[model samples]
Target: MRCVVMFSIRMDMRVILFLTLFTGLCIADSKGNLALNGMAVQSSLGHPQGDAQHAVDGNRDSDYKKESCTITKTEFNPWWRVDLGNVYSVSNVTITNRGDCCKDRLRGAQIRIGNKLDNNGNNNELAATILTAPNGTQTFSFESVNGRYVNIFLPGNDEILTLCEVEVFAVIDTPSYICGPRNLALGATAVQSSILSGAGAQRAVDGNRNSLFSLGSCSHTNADRDPWWRVDLGEKYKVTRVSITNIGDGSAARINGAQIRIGNSLENNGNNNELAVTVVSIPLGETKTFQFQPIKGRYVNIVIPGRNEYLHMCEVEVFSD
Candidate 1:
């Protein structure tokens, strides 16, 4: 009986050890410093050794002389930014201050994150503000903030921005379904209300997402009230989503407020079909996807109603479940 009890105790200890190690491994894998894989830029270079890339070079050397820091030229609203390539649910950002000298220069800097490039991303959502100089390395932890760009801006006249290291940690947010393959709109027939300068409706279904209007791959309609475009898939399909690419060069807001309708009815030029989604905005030269419950339709219409404006579309793609 004593020997059996000892064996049971040993087995329980081994199980506990295994669980602890497995949990540690999962936590480590889920979080990593994303700044290393991102692209870094600053308002201006102050020193040759103080390139923006140095701050994210996986180095924490706080001494500017060591060349592991970034220094921007003394100017108004000095700033630095990093592009994470894709949007993420960022959890925390770690910043290492210049330990060698002039740590006070970092005071009053703001950390911002978002997808907008307006004012060089300075208009993004604010995450934190440095109230005092960090002694060395300080971390600002916050709730999951979704964005693709992280910016550090110092708002003042003749203020300089310096950073030794910047680290970002995040988790991947997976979507319900991945889009690719089996597109029904590629081989469909497309038509528009009116053509402008030979910009026909078929260009929107050419399977090319080239956003440049001068490239002749986009569809254009003359300025008119309630201009519309439609696509026929030859057969009824349960469309799960529609992806629209907006003009890249300029005037992307023209596509805003457009309604996406899907149904078999051609009444009102299919503009009265079941509404799928309304386009709010698509960034310049970017694609915006609208996903919803499956809607059965043979005709897909994009109509901008109650206004007189040109309808421009770089590409339109339809997907089914």
Candidate 2:
């Protein structure tokens, strides 16, 4: 009788252990970071000083998507580039429109960043226009706070995105995000290559130089008012960085907001819905780049909640810690 009792007690312990492990895996697969500690995250709209300098890009990768490099659709026309330097701070940025011949000069333009993006709401968070140059290359920086991701939109008058060179500088001692909500301790940032759509959408690049990013959508011309998209990283992963490029559909297209979330999906109205998660949005597209304070999980959901038309989503990327 005593021997039987001992055997039964051991079996009970093993069952408990198995159950705990199984539960942990389920949470990791489902709620992701929320399955752990994702209950205390807020939006960072009015974050302090988040504007930085315009930088230049060097051809680092054979694929041109490796390290900070220039990407020009045409040759020497408007050769555009970006520099991924450690986060410092800045105020304004100046760009040199190195037009080839015929004063292929630049005209009006706008800057983009993480904050200016909609935080899943109609919150108008905009970085100030420090300076504009229709004449020549100039410098710009904003000191309202600290920001790293930067982009200068030189709306082509005719058909000229002729970017010659892009130069960037820094200010703050620490990387931005100190005031922003994404208090991420990042490793390296990479752009998810072709996998930007379909399944494996949320999958990020390996710590290696893997060019693959699948988040949010580029620009949807179909104009599905309630248009939406999602990402699945195969297995759960630790997300700690982001970089986005978006050119809102039109001037009146107010729905260029990004509703970002983390969690597992359960069935939705007709499809699956991201359940038990933490979500936030940034209206303006990622000016240059955006990093979050390391959140452990796998799935990330980007919802638009059906707003404006022509509200295209450009390159949506995520990074592992």
Candidate 3:
């Protein structure tokens, strides 16, 4: 009886060891990532003229100015990611870095996978890090994870994220739109350095397009150097674009050199804020839109530098995502 019991115990130990080795082998064999082309890719911010879907369009071009991929300004915890649409067992994530410039921008990037929306899906389980050479295409394989969202985030100050393409090998599912938050400027307050009587600052954002604030309905500033008009978007947003409709009848030229600025500060009349673009020309009575590499700000200012011209805007529109 004792000999039979010893033989059974040895057999059980051998089985356990074999199972452990077999599981390891299975994971190793699954290291080849599943291609995730055509997935919905998004970023914390997007340039106004470019869409976020470029990261998953299967294009490997990395030129920042090409508008084919996503790029974010230097900020705290910049992130970009993809949504698999439905939960799937993700095997690995492969990232294609910008081969043209700023290759070092991808180092220390953390690839996270989970379903949570907290912190824009960044507060998830970390899968891997781009610790090796930060250029070209690199693959990071890991244990299979069940998730609908796969995010790549750079944590810390002044982290700028740029992605040419991201491929996820996973059990397949169709993706949904993953754009960032929408326009948050509808009911915010407005202020100007000076306002002409009868044309309050509120006219610019009253959702009225044809109504001219300078034609007795729009806000107007005195003939002071650096005449400025501003709108408070109520809260900070990842500003994607700003649109302004110029009043016709030869009044549009007054806004020709105006600078569109955005930021959290009101210093230097908000001139210290980051400059998005300068208006070269806007056709008479036409609405012109200016886009930036999505910037975060609560205030949007349309100011003519170097005083003596009235800052007239018929309508101002802001959009995110």
TM-score per prediction, in order, is 0.49, 0.33, 0.43
How should the candidates be ordered by TM-score, best one leading?
1, 3, 2
TM-score of 2: 0.33
Instruction: Show model 2 residue runs off by greater than 4 Å.
Output: 1-56, 59-88, 92-94, 102-104, 112-114, 118-138, 141-149, 155-159, 173-321
Candidate 3 lDDT tens digits, 141-233: 887777667888887898778887777764322232121222344436888878767566777765444434434435666776888888898
Model 1 misplacement above 4 A: 1-31, 171-321
Candidate 3 runs further than 4 Å off? 1-182, 211-216
Q: Is candidate 1 or candidate 3 better by TM-score?
A: 1
Q: Candidate 1 lDDT, tens digit per residue, 150-176?
A: 999999999989999998866433341
Model 3 TM-score is 0.43
**lDDT tens digits, residues 170-213, model 2?**
33233441222222212222222123124222222211111211
**Candidate 2 global CA lDDT score:** 0.33
Tell me how far candidate 1 lies from the true structure as C-alpha RMSD in angstroms: 13.4
Of 1 and 2, the candidate ahead on lDDT is 1
Q: Please report, in order, the local distance difference test score of every candidate based on alpha carbons.
A: 0.81, 0.33, 0.67
